[model samples]
Target: MHYNLRHYRAEAERHSHADFHQIIISDVGKLELEVEGRAGEVCGRRMAFVEAGRSHAFRAEGLNRFLVLDVNIDLAHKTGIEALWQSRGRASAYLELQNGAQGSLLGLLDRRWFRSDASEFTGDGMPFTNAIGDPGLVDQIRLILGHSRQAVGTEKKTGSDIPTRLVRVMDWAETRLTEDIAISDMARIAAQSESTLFAAFQRYLGTSPMRWLTAKRLQMAWFLLQDCQIQLSIGDLANAVGFSDQSAFSRAFSRQFGRTPITVRRDARKLLGAKL
Candidate 1:
């Protein structure tokens, strides 16, 4: 959890973090970033993700302050950082932050990351304003850019219409939230190979298929946790959502929703109390 305000000197600074992922958000002025031979920049409206083990260099002129987050490579796996690394190049250049939520997201990040309370790129494939220091802030960023499509390379689909086969797959997954389903299972439902299914998901959903499945399962668990009409023990709720281990379920839920199962249940009780 390395969140800091960084400054690069006028000279080019080249380095690589082979053990962790680093997110660079532009603050005062423009900063050039070259990661793994690919180049991008961060202005007031841009940012960059430097994945682990990639050779990266940075250069900036005049006054500049950047907010950078260093994430463990393991945590980067299912949490939208992987696709971002894959989608960086050529046509997907300049990942720009979204319009309205940019201010709020940056404000929240500044409060949490910096001592004060404040944040793109050419590639709209990834949400640029994202700062994942807190679970609640991460969930907020999730809601803001959750609908945008992404691509693995450059052919990202920006259309609103969901791919028909993907829709079928989503609907099918919704019904089997409690089951032990995998990416192969989803590919089978889509009537395609796992690679093709993975590509389609990356192109249309901005995430991998298995990550989406985990998200869906956690979403169902959230719904159950917040429902006042139904009372399920935490372990029961976890089991109902395909989590054999309650501790793992709680960790995933907190990561996704910024709250624990017990907390969510308590909130529901508070809601009921208010209603009564």
Candidate 2:
């Protein structure tokens, strides 16, 4: 398992994890989540679950505080909670853990497993060592797993081939963000016709292939600017991410994020300095 404390502004793309199941609990502010074809907002006492191999995306409103758990599928299976893993391919892609159980589980994860300052932790091959040794923690895990299984069973399953194809195309596109990717290329990668690919993107992601690619490239640039340890000029960064001109990249970045690239870098450095 991996634990993280996140403060996100917005994530404007539909993305997914290939393996680990994700459980996110909101501590402050609301999270807009879209999984499969369902959409919702999670806040207060609600928690969202995205099973392994499912397509999901979320963006925070403002100053969101949340805890994320990326639990390995193998660990769930080994713990005799294979139902959670099995539910991945089903149409019930998004599940919620609500009310008192949500609070209790968040408390357990926060107090026992997480550090506020640390963004992530890996189990180092030992999954839930403390939970396995303690009966109370074991019960808590069981309770959480039981709710997951119940949620999976309660939702009606729908059949859709477009999402699977879209996921395949997205996986291919993410790796080649800096390259000139065309709709035909995406279609070839997904084994669908260009028209079919366009329809899939429109129906599932609410955008065209090129528009989605642009958003992804911009998001990548935003992260690269915030990494102060990486020594790269703005022009180099722009060229590296497929933008041919620094001025064009700056304009695009400001339009998307409402802040200049220079401002973002400056603010990130200030934040880092404060942390130091």
Candidate 3:
């Protein structure tokens, strides 16, 4: 039941945790959310529950802070948290907080819940075990999340420091991403043999260097499309991000962001209308 404060940039992201469920409540601006095939936005006291191990993605604009809690599945039933789920791990829920639910959740926002005191609610003294005995705080959780057909639901922090050598490669890739760069170029930049570079990338980033570069190129293209001022034509934009064929670039961009360049730019225009 440890809580965390997270900030998501406007850039789109897609990933998942295999061992824990995630509860996200927006504290500031809206967060575009797509979890396990359903899509919604979290804001205005709205919250979402993403069951353990489901693939999800999110994006946001302007300033935003989200209150995040990572829940262990085993603790769910034990803590009486599963009262909200409609169908266990396969289905997720999104709802607006009601009653004193918002207050109950926000009360736990004290920074101490995230640090050493995190253990204050586990084991025989388990938050759930204790919660069942006293029933005050856990009851509040059930009240808020148990709404029919609605609403929502930290942990072993994953990932390690990106190896220092790979950092050099990434920095070099960003500046020349528009240029025709290859794995050899990246390996040379890091002064590592191609095989070694491959190992490091697979071990750290879970992808090959060239694939990572292509993703980076597409991400850059996406950023450009979001900006109101960068008005390059689709073909020119494709070449600018190192894609030789405009059609191929469009397909890749669509695959990455689920929207064609034309569509993203059009949406950006609508959003930027007031600012411009």
Candidate 4:
């Protein structure tokens, strides 16, 4: 993972990343982001997500501070954070973190990522190491993942049975991410009643079935966007991801990833070049 502290005074030219996922957390002042063709503003303590190869630009209203993290795509996948990554595509343009969690995260970045004497720092009893190798990077990734999951209301599984049942439901939903999935569908797949399924999801995932399905579809769309081999128009991609209208798909995409489909495609083209 790569980290940077940005203090912005002017607008940045439109740019894209080829192989890194970006997390931009607003710390001070106001910042406006233009991704694809859409624009959104970040104020206060909020974070924005930009998938690899997505085109985006930024401008500041005044002095703006940002904590940015750029994580390798493959390492992200290897961290058992597929669920977080899948649902991340559905995050709003800027997500507000709880005060305690926000402070803790910022403090961690300050003490560990920015400071040279980070060797003295310990997080949850794990010794801090220079962010130079995969081990240290992966540890930092887990820290971010843990905090992000908590920030997004992802709950830890309390019971083994709940996870087993939820896994069955998730597996069924994953295969049909592009289909219109209902609570009944999940219930049937899990061999449980609708209420039982709902309870299981609530206990293990802390969300409803349809909401999870929507997240799954968004994740599928994100996955498709990253595949240079798949030549698809935004409308086609929307339809492929079970969205009936392009506008709705665009809205959902922007809400999830803080970037537009056009932006994603543009960045993908730049990253893949001839392959795309």
Candidate 5:
């Protein structure tokens, strides 16, 4: 399984997920997890996991510095790396290793490749030697995983007034064009009903939720294309802006900007007089 680090800070409260398992480790501030039908608090040196398909929400009390992993389960299973998950379940306490150390461990356990050559082992074999490792630290992390699973959770809604809620929702929407955000989910984040959110958005932004989301996505796509270091193809650009298909991105770009992405990239270069 491959993973990317996604940082989040919820001024209010929100739920986040992709199509994979998520492991969140908090190193600063506090967050309350609202998972299933229960609620629990996690703070410094704490870790939590939200399994794929579970409905979980979190709120950062103030500032929150954390690391999140979206794991590829199928790949893990195919490669016999599921032992990491099993170890975690058997361990009953959360693990808090230094960032650099944890990064090393995660790279070894979660992927088919490792930065250090000695970390590789084939088949069901154990590749690591105990000489340079601490068995106690490993045991602690696994315990944390089990403890987190046992700690069920829910948090009270933010309960901001309608207008205030709508404003925050709009701000969040503008920032997350690449996310598979849903209207119902947005409504929940805003502490409003679907109808209330719809009416407020139309009144405030002069657009429906999806239309506004599409426009934001296009704007983000345009910005990314204008970045000189970005060498992604149209399909890459499309996926970056939340359109899973290149054709959809092309059509939407043409409709909104009156040109294809290639033309837009060209025009941006011409405007900036950038040599490529």
Candidate 6:
């Protein structure tokens, strides 16, 4: 179940189905609301959630800006959407924001609106901003929530592209080579089954993920050793990139590039010596 905002006008907002729930907040002007066979009412700076099969029409007399969060309750529940949801599609959810959080959420929704309209941004994969609230906005939200609940956990990856996701996972692993990069975590980012991802990597990049990961580690180690400021022993660079033993790193490096890490570093030093 996707949650997004759709804006429409009086004449544009014609008779429609009541199968979805709408959370609407008028930011400006006025709107005349009517539930089928009922007296119409004017809505201003008001928010309401109208449920499915409930006949309703909204007509704004003048230019107005508002947010309409349309959600499918059944689908949302089935998908385990952890985001905040108002009472079972009956109450108008007017989120009273503290410390400018409301404005940020509005901005985020507006950006999604832009992306939804523009071909350059629209796609099948979920938009990155939608899954993880805007980083700056999320941080503030966390600060506000912190006072109300238990401590929040560390930041989680909110990215969803395959290649970009792979790069992000690898970058994190590069920093924490001492720890294993969970296969499950990588699978989540790739948005594919483990077998599918393996096949896709071989098809696209012509290498297995783990092999690619090892290559990246060796590359990082090589760079670290070549840097003049780095004064660590060969073993230090190996361990920094997840290799607990220098011999193992050397063997892997030699297998891939036909040269040991020490020789590579020595060769780099020679090049530097000649340049000086």
Better of 3 and 4 by lDDT: 3
Of the two candidates 2 and 5, the one with more favorable TM-score, higher being better, is 5
Query: What TM-score should be assigned to candidate 3?
Result: 0.42
TM-score of 6: 0.39
Better of 2 and 3 by lDDT: 3
Summarize candidate 4's per-residue lDDT along 30-121 as a digit string, tens digits. 66776676566654334566777778887775655666666677867776543464564354443444322333234335433566643321
* Tens-digit lDDT string for candidate 1 (121-185): 22212323344455554443333233222223322223377787886676556545566778888
Deviation from truth (RMSD, Å), model 2: 16.9
Per-residue CA lDDT of model 5 for 139-252, tens digit only, reads 323433323233222332323553767756755454345557899988987898999888887887788888877887786667656643345578866875678899988999
Alpha-carbon RMSD to native, per candidate: 16.6, 16.9, 18.4, 18.1, 16.2, 21.3
Model 6, which residues run further than 4 Å from truth?
Answer: 1-175
What's the residue-level lDDT of 6 in candidate 6?
34
lDDT of 5: 0.53
Q: Give candidate 1's whole-model lDDT.
A: 0.62
For model 2, the local distance difference test gives 0.62
In model 1, the runs with Cα more than 4 Å from the true position are 84-94, 116-134, 140-276
TM-score of 2: 0.43
The segments of candidate 5 whose C-alpha lies over 4 angstroms from its true place after superposition are 1-162, 270-276
In the range 132-233, model 2's lDDT, one tens digit per residue, is 234343344445544443234333332365466676567546545556678898999789999988888898879988888777778767766776654558
Error of 4 at 267 (Å): 46
lDDT of each: 0.62, 0.62, 0.64, 0.60, 0.53, 0.48
The alpha-carbon deviation from the true structure for residue 231 of candidate 2, after best TM-score superposition, in angstroms, is 1.3
Q: For residues 1-276, could you state the per-residue lDDT of candidate 3 as single tens digits? A: 434566677788888877766677665557888887788887644678887788888888887766666666776667657655554323555766442224323433322134543433211122311122433334434544653245444111122688767866775465455567778888997899999999999989899998888887887677656755544689976876778899999999999889999999999999888676
Q: Candidate 3 vs candidate 6: which has greater TM-score?
A: 3
Better of 1 and 6 by lDDT: 1
Instruction: Report the CA-based lDDT of candidate 6 relative to the real structure.
Output: 0.48
